[model samples]
Target chain A: NAGVIQTPRHKVTGKGQEATLWCEPISGHSAVFWYRQTIVQGLEFLTYFRNQAPIDDSGMPKERFSAQMPNQSHSTLKIQSTQPQDSAVYLCASSIGLGEDTQYFGPGTRLLVL
Target chain B: QQQVRQSPQSLTVWEGETAILNCSYENSAFDYFPWYQQFPGEGPALLIAIRSVSDKKEDGRFTIFFNKREKKLSLHITDSQPGDSATYFCAANQGGSAKLIFGEGTKLTVSS
Candidate 1:
């Protein structure tokens, strides 16, 4: 298995620009999650989808951040007007089932906003 | 506020020694706890997990000792090796919620 595939392992964007990260979940998985990892906050959940439906996005920033799972096989996280604080490793994970199931993760996309 | 917390941000141990990492959670509803280990430049991988009903769970050289009353749990790595050095994160899941609450990781260093 390729596990979960995240495109553009690294991304750098200037401040005020838009940044988009993509994730391709493993086949047959029903749940996908997005997380951001930084030295200060550690790994924090941003949003999640179950069977291509948005389940929870409480972790997302009130503004500038949004996520969408148009279909079961893929999802995207977009940040508009990106700032330096947005620079971090964006991780994507998928689970075979809901709640407490083992999550398989992608290597992550390292985003740098200058 | 963070729901899960881990102690000793970093720890060092000599080869063949035992290393213990501690974690505690504030939400009593959390029943399933899992530990993930991450190497540099790689995503975190599930190591071992335990449920509230069981006081302990062992897998090979790794063991988890959980105390439901105290809302605390710990990961113990026996016969540690240099390869065991990595960041360890403790996570909690409640009921049927697919979401997890993670604790700030504990960085472990094993020296030969």
Candidate 2:
């Protein structure tokens, strides 16, 4: 198994620009999760999708952050009007079917907003 | 507020020695706790986990001691090695919830 695959190992965007990160979950896994990791905030949950449906996004920033899982195989996280403070490693993880299952993470996209 | 927390921002241990990493949670609803280990530039990987029903969980060299009443847990790595150097995160999730709350992490370094 290739495990989870995330595109653009690193991303650089200027202020006000938009950044879209991609994640392809492991085969047969029904749950996908997005998280942001920073020096100050540690690892923070951004959103989650189960079976291609958004289940929870309480941790997402109300305005510019958005995530979607169009199918069981992949999910995406988009950040609009990216600011310098938005720089962080965006990680994607997947599990068999959620509900206390083990989550396997991808390499992550290191986003650096300039 | 941080729902999950880890102690000792960083630690150093000698090879073959036992290394202990501490964690605590504020939410009593949290029933599943997992410890993730991350090397520089890599995403965290699950190293060990324990449910609220169990006080202790062991796997090879790693063991987790959980205290349900105190809302606390600790990861013990026996016979530590230099390769064990990494940041360990304590994460928690309530049953049936898809989201996982993570702690700030504890960086451990094992010297040979």
Candidate 3:
């Protein structure tokens, strides 16, 4: 199934520049999730979408982070005016459905803000 | 406050030995628990999972022993091999929520 696919396996940007990460979910899956992994925070749930509609984004940073699932095939997470603290491994996952469903994750994009 | 927590941030065990990774949660609403294994540069993959209704769930060399009363669970990897070395994360989900609360993760290293 090729599982989930993430583009730009590695990304580097200036401290103030913006970064956009992409995720292509598994075909026929209805739920997509975004998570950020750091040495200090571990895996933090950033947001999620179900059937192309955003379900919850409570974990997203209030100002700089935003996510969108424009269609069933893909989702994007954008970080505006990125800071050094935003540098981390961003992971994307997809599931057949929500709640108790098994989530398959992509390799993730490693963002480095220098 | 972290809702889910894992112990022994890192562990090392000899090949053919059994490695036990422990986890505990503070939320009583969490009913579904899943363990994910991640290599150095890859995303996490589902290893084993258990529901609150069962006390034990096994899959090949991996098993989950859950204690609902204590709000704790442990993953037991028997006959461990070098390939089993990776970070293990314990995650929990509430009844109807899709969001998973992940623990700090335990890094396991099985030496040959």
Candidate 4:
């Protein structure tokens, strides 16, 4: 199996520019999640989707962040007007269903906003 | 609010020694606990996991000790090796929720 796949392993954007990160979950997995990792914040949950429906996005910043999973295969996280504070590794993970299932993760997209 | 807390932001241990990392969660509904290990420039991978129903789960040199009442857990790496140096994360899933509450990672360094 290919595990999870993330595109543009690394990204660099000028301040105020927009960035979009992509993720392809393991086949047959029904749940996908987005998380941000930084030295200070550790790992913060951003959002999650189950069966192509957003289940929770309370962790996402209201104004600049949005996520979508149009189909079972892939998901995207978009950041608008990106700031230096948004420079961090964005990780995507997937599992068979949820809960106790082991979440397999992708290598993650490293976004560096300058 | 931070729902999960981890101790000792970093630790250094001698080779062949045991490294113990602690974690505590605030939510009682968290029934699934998993520990993830990540090396620099790589994504986190499941190291070991334990359900609330069990107090301990062991795989090779890694073990997870979980406490339900105190809402605490610990990951113990026995016979640590330099290869084991990485950031360790403790996470919890509450009531079948897809989201995982993660503790600030603890970086472990095993030196010869």
Candidate 5:
């Protein structure tokens, strides 16, 4: 299997610009998750979706961050007017279902906001 | 509220030595715990996991000792090698959710 695939493995964006990251989950996987990893905050849970519907997004910043699961095979996380503080590796993972299943992760998209 | 906490921001150990990384959790509902290993520039992978019902789980040289009552657990890597050097993270899941709360990763360096 291809596991999970994330696009633009590395991205550099100027401050105040928008950046969009994409994820294509494994075939037949119904659940997708997003996380932000930084040296200081570690791995922070950003959001999750099940069956193309959002389940939890409490960890996402209310102002500038948004995620969408428009179809079963893909999802996207977009940050508007990114700041230097937003620089971090964005990770996407997928699983079969919501209960106790192992999550297969993608290589992740590293965002560097200048 | 940070449900999980891990200790020793970083550790260095010699080959053939054992390295123990500690973790504690605050959520009583957490029933599943898993350890993940991540190399540079890659996503974290599952190392080994333990359910709250079990006190210990072992896979090859890696072991997880869990204390459900104390809400604490640990990962022990026996016979460490230089290739084993990476960041280890402890994660927990409550009974109802599939979401995992991760701890601040512990970086391990195994020297020759």
Candidate 6:
């Protein structure tokens, strides 16, 4: 298996610009999760989707962040008008399902908002 | 409040030594515990995990000793090697919650 594939491992964006991160999860997986990782805050859950349906997004910032899983194979996290504080490594993971199952993660996309 | 917490912000141990990383949770509902290892420039990967049904779970050289009464768990890495050095994270999930609550990672360095 190819595991999870993420695009543009590194991204640089000007403050106030929009940034979109992509994730292609492992085949046959049904659950996709998006998280943000930083040295100061560690890993913070952003949103999740199961079988192309959004399951929960309580962790997402109220204003600028949004996520979508149009299909079972991939998901995307988009940050609009990104700020310096939005800079972090955005990670995507997938699992067979919830409850006691292991979630496999992708390498993550490092976003630098300058 | 942080539901899950990990101790010893960072730890350093010599090769061939045993490095123990501790974690605690405040939620009684959390039944699944997982330890993830992250290398620099890479996302975290599942290292080991345990369920509330068991007090101890061992896989290879990494073992998880969980205390249900105390709501604590520890990951012991035996025969630590330089390659084992990375940031280790403790995460918890409840029976229904799909997302994991992660603790501030504990950075480990194994010196050869």
Mind giving the per-residue lDDT tens digits that candidate 3 earns over B1-112? 9999999899999999999999999999999999999999899999999999999999999999999999999999999999999999999999889999999999999999
TM-score for chain A of every candidate model?
A: 0.98, 0.98, 0.99, 0.99, 0.98, 0.98
Which is better, 5 or 6, measured by TM-score? 6
Ranked by DockQ, the better of candidates 3 and 5 is: 3
Query: Which portions of model 6 show Cα errors greater than 4 Å?
Result: none
Q: Indicate the residue-level lDDT of B36 in model 1.
A: 97
Q: After superposition, which runs of candidate 2 have C-alpha atoms over 4 Å from their true positions?
A: none
Record all residue pairs in model 3 with backbone atoms less than 3 Å apart, i.e. clashing: none
**TM, every model:** 0.99, 0.98, 0.99, 0.97, 0.97, 0.98
DockQ metric for all predictions: 0.86, 0.89, 0.95, 0.88, 0.83, 0.93
* Candidate 5 lDDT over residue span B1-112, tens digit each: 7789999989999999999999999988999998999999899998999999999999999999999889999999999999999999999998778889999989999999
Question: Per-residue lDDT tens digits of candidate 5, residues A26-71?
Answer: 9999999999999888899899999999999988999999999999
Q: Report residue A110 deviation for candidate 1 (angstroms).
A: 0.6
Which pairs of residues collide in model 5? Answer: none
lDDT (Cα, 0-100) at A21 in candidate 5:
100
Instruction: Give the poorly placed runs of model 5, Cα more than 4 Å off.
Output: none
iRMSD per model?
0.8, 0.7, 0.5, 0.9, 0.8, 0.6
The superposed Cα distance between candidate 4 and the true structure at residue B77, in angstroms, equals 0.7
Worst 10 residues of 6 chain A by lDDT: A96-105
Best by lDDT: 3
Of the true interface contacts, the fraction found in model 5 is 0.78
Q: After superposition, how far is residue B51 of candidate 2 from its true place, in Å?
A: 0.5
Candidate 2 lDDT score at position B18: 98
Over A7-109, each residue of candidate 4 has an lDDT whose tens digit, in order, gives 9899999999999999999999999999999888989999999999999998999999999998999999999999999999999999998878889999999
True contacts kept of each: 0.80, 0.88, 0.95, 0.93, 0.78, 0.95
lDDT of 2 by residue, B71-104 (tens): 9999999999999999999999998787889999
Q: What digit string (tens of lDDT, one per residue) describes model 6 on residues B29-71?
A: 9999999999998889999999999999999999999999999
